[model samples]
Target: MFNRYEADETYGLHVDNAIRRVTGSSVTVRADLSATLFLSDPEGYDGGELQIEDSFGAQRAGFELPPGVEAVNLKDRPPLPRAVLEPHQSIVFQGMMGEAPRWEDLHWLQRQTELPILVKGIQHPADALRVAEMGLDGVVVSNHGGRGLDCLPSAIEVLPRIRAAVGEDFPLLLDGGIERGTDVYKALALGADAVMVGRPQIWALAVAGALGVAHLLRVLREELEVTMALAGTPTIADITAEALFSGP
Candidate 1:
C-alpha cells in the first residue's frame, strides 16, 4: 500500500451512463506491457479518469528503462539486447503520459477524483507544504532513487526539514536508500510515517526468486528487532529520536 508504485485496475473510475455516449470512443494508450487510462474523449463525455502509478518527480517528460524493453525473452531467454545508445543517452518512452507531472496537473486531477492521491519525488519542505495546500493525501519523499538528477540530495537527508514543514499530522513517507532495517528505524525516527524500498526486492528476485524475497524480508525483520532491542524500544511506537544514536 505504501510502495513508490501503485496501480488501480489500470482502469479505476467510470463515466455515468447518462453522459456516456457509445459514439464517444475512449482514446486509449496501449503501452507494450502496461495500459494507462486517460480521459480520452473528455469533450464527448462528462466524467473520465487517469492514473500514474509512480506519480511524480522528473526533470523531463515521460519515463523509461535503460533498454532491453523491446527485447523478447522466450522459453530459452535471450541475452539482453545490446545497448543501442550510449550509456547516458536516454531513450524516450512514447506511450507514457507525456510530460513530467506538473503543479497544474495535480490541481486538475483534484477536480477529477475523490480518491486519495499522493505525489512522489518530493524532497523539499516547501513542496511538501504545497502538497498539503493542494489537498493531496500525502507525499513520498524521494529523489526518484537519485537516478534522475545528480544534484538532488538523498531522501533521508532532507526528511527532517520536510517533517518540520508539514507538521506531525501530515502523512509523510520516505523512499530511497532503504537497504536495512536500521534504515527503516532511523527513517521513522526522522519523522516518516513509513518507508518504501526498491532495489533490494529486485536483487532478491534476481538471486533466488520469491523464496529469496521472503528470506530478505525475514532478515530485515530480524535486524529491526535487534535494533529495537538494543535501543530498548519494545514497539514501533517507542522508536523515537531517543532510539536514534545520531540526531536526524
Candidate 2:
C-alpha cells in the first residue's frame, strides 16, 4: 500500500504491492488488504481525496467499484467527488482503513513536519521505548481502547512498565477502563501523563448532548480534585508513585 502525507501529495488510482519494506534495510511485509487513515483533520488540508475506481475490484455484490471499473489507467477515469458519499457509508468500501505504521514510517513522518506526532495503540514497554527512541512527541499506552482483541492485559496493568521504559518526562497517555476521577488518579500515579476516557464521554453525550459532556468533564475534574485532597495530595506532581499500591 501507498501513503500520501502532504497536503498536495496524491496517489493516483493504482494497485498495491504484495510486499512492503518495513525497515530501512530489507524487512518486508506481505499485504492482503489495502487501507487508508486520514491522519489530518478534514478541514486541516485540502484536495486529498481517496478515490477508488470500479475497475480495480469489487467492493460488494450490489455496490460494485463503480461503472466501468476496469480502467487501469487513472487518466481513463478521473476521481469522483468523495464528499458526495455519506460519512458512515464509506466504511464498508474501505475495508480495514488504517495500518500499524512502522518505525521507519514514523521516522520519515518526523522529518516531514515540525508538528508533534503521538503514536497510539502501544501496549508493550518495548514498543513504547521504540516510540520514545524515534523522538516522537508522545505516546498512548493503549489496547486500542480494548477494541482490538480478547484476553489482553488492561492498559493500567502495563502503564508503569511503559513509564519506566520512556522515563518520567516523556508524555505518556493511557486509554482503557478509565471511568471515574479515581481511575484517572490511578493512571497518573502509575505514570501516565494523562488518561483518555472514551465510553464515559459517549454515554454522557448520549444522555445529555453537549451540555452533558461538559458537565461530565467538570464532574470528573472535581472528583479528581476531591480524590487528591482526601489523599493528602495538594498538587499534580505530589501524586507520584508513592500514591499507589499493589492490592490482593
Best by TM-score: 2
Model 1 residue 104 lDDT score: 98
Would you list the C-alpha lDDT of every candidate in the order shown? Answer: 0.74, 0.76
Q: What CA root-mean-square deviation does each model show from the true structure? A: 19.6, 17.9
Off-target runs (Cα >4 Å) in candidate 2 are 1-100
TM-score for all models, in order of appearance: 0.59, 0.60
Candidate 2, 1-248: lDDT as tens digits = 44545577655544244333444444434333445567547555544434333333344444546576655877577665222222233322442233335578988998899998999888888998988887888998888755568778998898888898888899998888888899999998999888888898999999999999999999999999999999989899899878776777
Q: Per-residue lDDT for 14-48 in model 1, tens only? A: 42211111234442221222333345553454433
Which candidate gets the maximum lDDT versus the true structure? 2
After aligning candidate 1 to the native by TM-score, how far in Å is the CA of 180 from where it should be?
0.7
Q: After superposition, how far is residue 191 of candidate 1 from its true place, in Å?
A: 0.5
